[model samples]
Target: MSFSRRAISLCAAVTLSYGVISPAIAQAQDFNGIVDSVHTHAADDASAKMAPLGSYASGQLAESAAEIVAFHAGSKRILTVNALSGEIDVLDASNPQKPTKIGSVSAGADKEINSVTVREDGLAVAAVQQSNKVLQGEALFFDAAADDLGAAELGRVTIGALPDNVHITDDGAYALVANEGEPSNELDAAGTAYVADPAGSVSVITLPAPGTVEAATQADVRTAGFEAFDAPGALHEDIRIFGPVNHHNKPSLDLEPEYVASAKGKAFVTLQENNAIAIIDIASARVEKVVPAHIADHLQVPIDSSNKDDKAELRTIPVKGLSMPDSIHAFTSGGKTYFATANEGDAREWGVEEKDGGSGVYTDEVELADVIDNGQVCEGVLDDVEAEALGDKKVAGNLKLSNVSGWDEEKQCFDELYAYGSRSFSIYDEAGNVVFDSGSDFEEITASLNQPGVFHHNADNEDPDFDDRSDNKGPEPEALTIGHIGERTYAFIGAERVGGIFVYDVTDPANAKYQTYINNRDFTVDFDEDNYDSTKLAGDLGPEGLAFIDKQDSPNGEYLLVVGNEVSGTTTIYEVESVVEKEPSTSGSTKGSSNLSRSSLSSR
Candidate 1:
């Protein structure tokens, strides 16, 4: 099933003439029938100008300096979140080939910055979590155009706890913050119970009008709380509410806002752990509704559910995947708004680890084999024929599932199995109805490439072992951004684990076509987590955030995509080229042939 690199390159070159086709045309031609007109370009086709800023503390997790990133067009500066140092690293991005670190902005020694956003006029706002994350956080504003970036603090306004992400309105009139409200892992003083969890909420900050010097203050800040959903029957049963019972027993505390996307006067916040989206009325500072995300059915679309198969093996299984999206973006087309999400799944695992002298009481993850051995699975639920198919280690036995769901209370056992993430991206309407989902395409596309020795399919960020992450979220698509180029709109999605950026043409939200996949890492390098070296041959790893710079705003005057790689502690700038469609020839050959060879879509 593996193809030579030369053969993949040849396939990519020949497919360049056939631009993306609409879903209707693809269906009419009886195409492979996944997404329409999928294509994967050669590595040389999408080369990037990367700036590898070394890690904060080598060989340590969560110590890498770079995470989320923001670009200020006015100043041509790239502001990146250095969580380890709790500061924003400002880089002069005027030269895309060689970006230099100029200065940094910090609220204080005790503040930890989570997210940042910049306006056209050089106004930068950062979401700062307090030293004690349970306490109220703050939104600190700065004038990035100032001569001294570090000393250009404009002002600060108090917000909710653990403000994880911030986004500015298109008109620059407001700043919306998604306060995650994560609880501390430590137990109560008595060491026998959990403490009260902080309620998750969103804060809307009304920025000063255009050409005004006035700064935003506490009076301009309004909080949107989730208390309205605390009542019984307020939340959908599908929306997860499972956390430490003592602390997160209520929907108000269980729902943690992860990211924010806005359109018109409303904001859509992703509650990752809850597997839902919270709609907020910005002007009124109220949560209108919480809509549960769609569960991915693997029975219709296959997935690689095993790491022990020794190669990329996709198969259908009796399991459902939760679309716990981590990042979301909103765009309007045909007078209607659509939200695109990277369905990177998540689980609720809190409290100190057993290795750190505390019980793992809040973890909800379990393996299928362990669930069966512990007698938690319902008897007679799986017939002998069905059990035999999923009983081996190379099958569904080692697959990870959530222990908090699918419980049959009356029977005291589980009736179904649930996995973490959908391993794809989806488009949803304003009402949260799924318009289109890239079902099994991520894994299928990656597996089809099969680049030997380098860029293994479904490999982990720290290691190049192929199919290593099949048992978990395969090719986890966590970072996402949407941009409009010419008459078409494209969505740039980053796979955090497999280390690449996937481009999709989403002009027609319901008929998104895959454009290309690009990964810069050289897998031959020896990447040992215990003795890591950022300056080695390692490329960008763990893409956590993506910012699209239009041709007009781009420093180099070309469409640019800025990525923040958290694991390798690097920020890369990729030049994006629009795909030009060619008219079909008048020859007797079929124009949109479904019988096109699969090698034409293979990537290297």
Candidate 2:
């Protein structure tokens, strides 16, 4: 549905990029059941200003920042894994805004550490992929005080192809690792499928009691429920297949475990490509169930599918897409376990090269003609002559959906398959049932406040590619972490493309309330269209990992939010406070009742 300007002005509280709207505007706005007034919790102390009190520098060109974890050792410090340099840099963050580099540790020469988890006692586990080859990764442990490479090593356990994520249980008894055995981009001689089997699994690290940290053993849980969950396509016709020629491979062989979270003796692992979540019993090191998180039907769900490069306008299109979650984190509230994911969708490619001589958009124009035409529900997009002209245009290989029904002549909808990600954050119950989804909240909120010429701009660069990211993943909510302050629970979702943190009150997982949005990137400067310098861009860019330190654990006794920006190679920090004076958005009387639509809650 096209949002009228009057509706937008009426429903949205006018907000500037770096400033809050007037009290009258905040009071006038009514977002149906959504939060109306949003506020920023900047640091109260003069020493720390807004977000990014301080930033730790990493690599310049290639994305060096990956994951980060904060723990109080001696004083509060932050540990960040630089994927480009393969170094674990330690920073002194006792002061939130003015963090200084204290020490550094290396994973190896060229190895990339995907993730790190630190316990209260300073025992940390890092998932390191030694080689690009499948199954060459390992789980490495380090004592809290150990600094140098050799001195930090406590023990090492061999894992699978690619250890994508690692998390230590709350009690520190076990550490779970998601080994994403992703297939190589190299295709077979026939150019039909991947060369290596993309079988992914989880590894459990048995940690000794409180004192004996050196005695640790790793268990590979790949074979658990291998037959049931990862059966061949013949056994389950609905199984997702990337390409047609991979019929010889089984689903178990291609289920790449993307991220993992552990709570109450169980680990929740997300299989991004397979669109499933594997619940693992940590004690037995077995998979209980591989629940399929199905496709998001566009018909019921309202999504913004218009090209992001267009001038700052949001068009909520009804198009189906796969909800391939990238980063998953778990939390608990009111005796029930809940988890949230940054649905920054992803896909794989290998068979062919792009005609444009670039890394992205590997499919040639001719191959995408049918899908793009099918992508549109209306008529006349693809005539006999237009089909011949499409050979000159290029599109991404996976953008087109394979199973979309031919265009509906009357309704004028192709039922075209959208991209992979839900482009928002989702909350799931313990049984993997959908509780709440942020829906077009990210798109709507961002579009309402973003400055002109910067909509859907990638956070990584100074050149604002206005509306460039809208076609793919809008905002691309990549990093998610939840923290509790007083009786309220806030979920912070980092938008990788636009460079901001979306705050939502998920205290009630069933009906989460949007709290506020905060971004520290520098937005005052204009884009230097000629020679682009990413560092000069406003605000931090490419937020890859987020660490939410509670008020109690925080060094300054304030709620601390740490974000690692991958493109700019820096770890930015924020001090936030929750000011709850108004009633919850879900409880009060609302305007625009029709606007309160259930987010693509589940694939029907």
Candidate 3:
């Protein structure tokens, strides 16, 4: 995985044929380049198919019992973060269809376990945050295969505040942690702002190689901090640096590290609130550069910007969106590394008196109509046609926009309106340039599906009301991971709200194509947490994390996609198959050819 600059062409292939070709044949031929390029070690007509295999329920609804997940190959076990119980629940996946809870790991009484990962040798690491998240956290290690499962402690190392995510390299040489230093809800003594806001950072720990009896210590921890960006003008103007001023009054405190994806001595961190990606030199433990994420133009990428519209419909609007990516994963394609992100937007609304019992309030979210009524928007910001459309509550008027961005200081008003999350997934090159984006494809594809009772476009995970999350981040692509099957690389993305997985073939980063979309949720169930029946086949809901197991490590000798559903507290295993599509019959009847349903949406 070396970093190299290359020009990626986005031109569509021209079709100039003499014979009359059927649309299906033409479409199949269109994928010839992609199919031919990766089929050196695979079948030429092979494509991916995914379906549910099994599920294990914690019986804890809406409690976030199952969030992050990792697999232990040697032990034949699956580890998931049970945030509600503050523990790691270990399951025996030797029998993939009936994975039962075998044991659990606890980092003492009051610690909150946010993430967990396992090395190839069955060594497990869990990121533990303090009860008060603003305080410093720690990473706990365990022998995952111990008889009592997690009862054998391997080691522990002190980390930064609120360690939200942890990852181990394939070689198991280093462990990376994202310390999301969030602010406390309590107000300061002056009652003007938050009590404390710690500076966010990334902790890189040098771990002992596999089979080593020694453990990582505090001395092995090296922090990648943002102090260098604290200087004025160091951060780009496009990188968001707003919210109630922290006590430290440094830009470092405002830049929270949300997720990390590393490769070849370089780590790419998602600064979700800042709308940027910070590249870190892992060897030097220093910030290299912060690349601002693209702000999507709604006119070109249509969106459903209003929940009040009473239906799910994509429309062109006069607005831009901040692509605040949450989870990112790195993969190599054509000998170059590319990063894929789930552009799940977020809002910084902290210390609300009613919600958190705080004395003060701090938020950057405001309604588009509110900004207009308050005279915070410029007089001629919207054209006559744009004004009429945006003035309707069923359109962009009810959409949520960031008040901290698009401000014209000299004019004392906002010249442009910005929304949260682009509501899609994107592929970025080494330089953080957008190689490809699934612009509005997630919403449109989900809406076109015939899954009437199971899924509703833009609906919340807990409530199946249509268009409920439209005004917010629709579908909210938050979970992401990459896998290789049959010489082709695929990116699996999960929608946090609608609760499903979208698969794409990224063998060619510039020409990624959609493969399939599968969701296990049975929306017909009355989702009442208290009286919910775990035995019912309600399916998994609120997918928070995804892990892809190659066929070599799979228990059933098949590719597997594991999903940890936060809302339903269930961990599901989906068997992925690479099937060869059968050619049409000579009698003109084509049926049951094993060809998976591919999305018809156009690529960006």
Candidate 4:
């Protein structure tokens, strides 16, 4: 059902992107029962950014574990090689509850790593660490012995140190490793992952510049067109290509960042953190640009979020947000290109800094300016970006400000500059305009609120009133991701201060629902559904990574579900069978007299 103009205008406050209408958010709160009605959290969330044993080994965990295999299916049992655990679990979902645990292996000393791959021969190829930290060691190949369900001892071959990733050619006849492992800014840390083979062969790749070679690097030049390459260490035999990262001029962490993915005809790499996605041109050993977002070549990330209880010591550049971007992914759609980065909010928000860095100075100095019509460039822009637009109106002695992007559809740029309500999902178009907002749209949906509100962390419960223009403040999405399977699209959202994932269905693009297990017609399920009609299943946790492996159009032919665990340091895989669609017991009507409308909530 549609709303009258007056009813729809009431939602002017429910803007989709950047301050569409601040008054609406305030108005929702003023409604009382409506705001509190939404309260349902997802199930799994073991996240707590822990101080590492010697600094984190890697962020993007790729293990050949069972969960990984359930998501990526092939003739050979593939697993997401967990660098920390040094083991792989078999993700055979014949039985969902009891995922088989296949034998484990150990990443030799300081080799704490990030991603990994396994060859048809069961040889595990992983990206290990090589630096001052504990995981600093050479990328090695360990033969998997499934005897112990993953605790077996396997032989090893040292490939290269400070490694990034390891790759095996399709025929399995050749293997490659990318080693760009240099000490990260935070000592013990290295930005590079290497590609290597079991024969002790290795190749190092440097970070790619954001706009160094344009659109996307040529696939052939990604690895310099070499069938083979070697590390700097001892021998130089059959070195068909130059080193990926030369000692003297290694690319910055933000530039030419190395990451590998297999595409249709060839292997493509992403210069992550950088603005380009380089598809490897294996023949000539060069990389071609498949995507370029005009981002930093090597992301200039702040070293630490904290420097004691004082100010954070910031670096001299801006690769991402005013702070640092913790994670990133290479995403593409239609004919357009994009990259989704999870920028951990500013350090000051965390409330621990250095004296000189910021003594009582509130970085929350942001003021809401008049909403600009980004639909058309300058024609809609509001003047005075430096000053507030509420006409010198102080909101409880604080300046009034506009709401940030709820969901940008034009996603040409990274999702860092915008504001995604703490643990909210925002989808942008290739052009960077917000297209959907799961948070605002799913209003009243219990799963929508409690699931994603894991991060409404506000030291001060300062309320911002647009009607009166009060300063109601809260946290933003700690991290956000989109996953599409079949005709269904799901968003797994993470909260900053809180733990767990919020699942939202954006199949309709505008209105949506939270993935729920039980069919309930409650205020939290306000987006209609019919409100929990059992179209999809919902799970929870600090889901850092999400994948819909069972899409009909997918290359892999498996009905799978994969969720990355940021807290437990493990990727969970599930076989999501088709949902048995069913309507709830309630009729087509509003259970309570709340201002939230099904269409309005979903539309926003």
**Best model per lDDT:** 3
Candidate 4, residues 1-604, lDDT tens digits: the string is: 1100011122322342211111122233222111222223222221111010001111222222211221323322335455445544444433332334343455655446555555544555555564343233444444442445334334333433355555555445334455443322221112122222111112432212321211111221123322221224212221011122322212322133344433223444433222233345444445343343222111232111111212111121111222123333334444344334333332212122345663322222233222222221122122333122222222111222212221133742223222212113433333333344332222222212221112121111111111111122122334444565544555444433223334544444434345521110111211211322221011122334444444352233434445444432344443333343332212222211133322111111
lDDT of 1: 0.75
Provide the lDDT at 423 for model 1. 92
Compared with the true structure, all predictions reach lDDT values of 0.75, 0.61, 0.77, 0.31
Give Cα distance to truth, residue 392, candidate 4, Å. 12
Superposed by TM-score, candidate 4 places the C-alpha of residue 185 at a distance from the truth, in angstroms, of: 4.2
User: How far in Å is the alpha carbon of 593 misplaced in model 4?
Assistant: 20
Q: How many backbone clashes does every candidate have? A: 0, 17, 0, 127
Which is better, 3 or 4, measured by lDDT? Answer: 3
lDDT of 1 by residue, 1-604 (tens): 1101111132432444532222222234431212233323322222222212112221234355678888888788888888878888888889865577888888699889999888888888899999999999999998877789868789999999999999998988999999999877766654444565788999999999855534589999999999889898999889988765455468888789999999988899999989999989988989999999878877766778888877667777777899899999999977899999999998776665556665644677888777766777788766656665575668767888888778787988888878989998988999889988878767766776655664478888877788888888899999999987787777888999988887776777876666567665666655665555432345667889889888899888988888888877777776676646432222221111121223222221
Name the weakest run of 10 consecutive residues (lDDT summed) in model 1: 1-10
What TM-score does candidate 3 reach? 0.87
Candidate 4 TM-score versus the reference: 0.44
lDDT of 2 by residue, 1-604 (tens): 2111211231233332334312221123321111122223221111112233455555353355645555654448788877777767778888765567777667777688888878777777888897675756877777655645347777777877788888888888887888888777566655556667656778877777765556366443233334465444433333353443544456667778888887798888888876677888888889887776645654455444444223444332334556778788889978889888888776555445645563322221122344555454355534554444332222122233333223354675553444567767888988888888766667666565545532333323443455556556668878888887777777888888777787777777876766556665554444443423533344356678888888778877877888887755668776666554333345521112123221111110
Q: Give candidates' CA RMSD values in order.
A: 8.5, 8.5, 10.0, 16.4
| TM-score list, all predictions | 0.86, 0.80, 0.87, 0.44
What ranges in model 3 sit over 4 Å off?
1-46, 189-191, 245-249, 352-359, 450-454, 534-536, 581-604
Higher-TM-score candidate among 3 and 4? 3
